[model samples]
Target: MSQRDLAKHLGVSLGGVNYCVKALIDIGWIKAGNFARNEDKRVYAYLLTPKGIAEKAALTARFLRRKMDEYDALKAEIEQLQAELAADGR
Candidate 1:
């Protein structure tokens, strides 16, 4: 998708998308190439490098672990509330 489309889809400003894309390119995570034979030279296709894929996987794992920890804490809180209610005969 075009940068404008990406920005709209992500609910961010166009400049925000451009900044992030540039950062990824600079870090060797993603490569941006013009679409061959496309009339518009401004159009680019962003592809993830192998390093990017690995980074994404690691990020996903961390996100899941954090969410699981949050879930466990919430479950414990709920159980404690239920126990308090039972003790109060509510």
Candidate 2:
């Protein structure tokens, strides 16, 4: 994605996206290549390496687990509040 698009979607600064992209390229996690946009200009494309794919999978798993834990906590809290309300009404 373009750095500007990425930054806007991520709700971060454009510079932050540029820095992260540079770091990923430096670490060999992603590669950047220029594609012809027209006769006069080119656009950059970023491709993920195999290592980057693995890392993304790992990160996704971690994020899923974290969100699941949060969901469980919130569910428990809601149930507790409902029980308290029921008791108070009785």
Model 1 agreement with the true structure over 1-90: per-residue lDDT tens digits: 888999999999999999999999999899989978999889888999999999999999999999999999999999999999999999
Best by lDDT: 1
lDDT of 1 at 19: 99
Clashes of each: 0, 0
lDDT of 2: 0.90
Over 1-90, each residue of candidate 2 has an lDDT whose tens digit, in order, gives 678988999999999999999999999889988867555354788999998999999999999999999999999999999999999995
lDDT of 1: 0.95
Per-prediction TM-score: 0.85, 0.72
lDDT score of residue 34 within candidate 1: 92
Q: Which stretch of 10 consecutive residues in model 2 shows the poorest summed lDDT?
A: 34-43
lDDT for each candidate structure: 0.95, 0.90
Predicted structure 1, TM vs. truth: 0.85
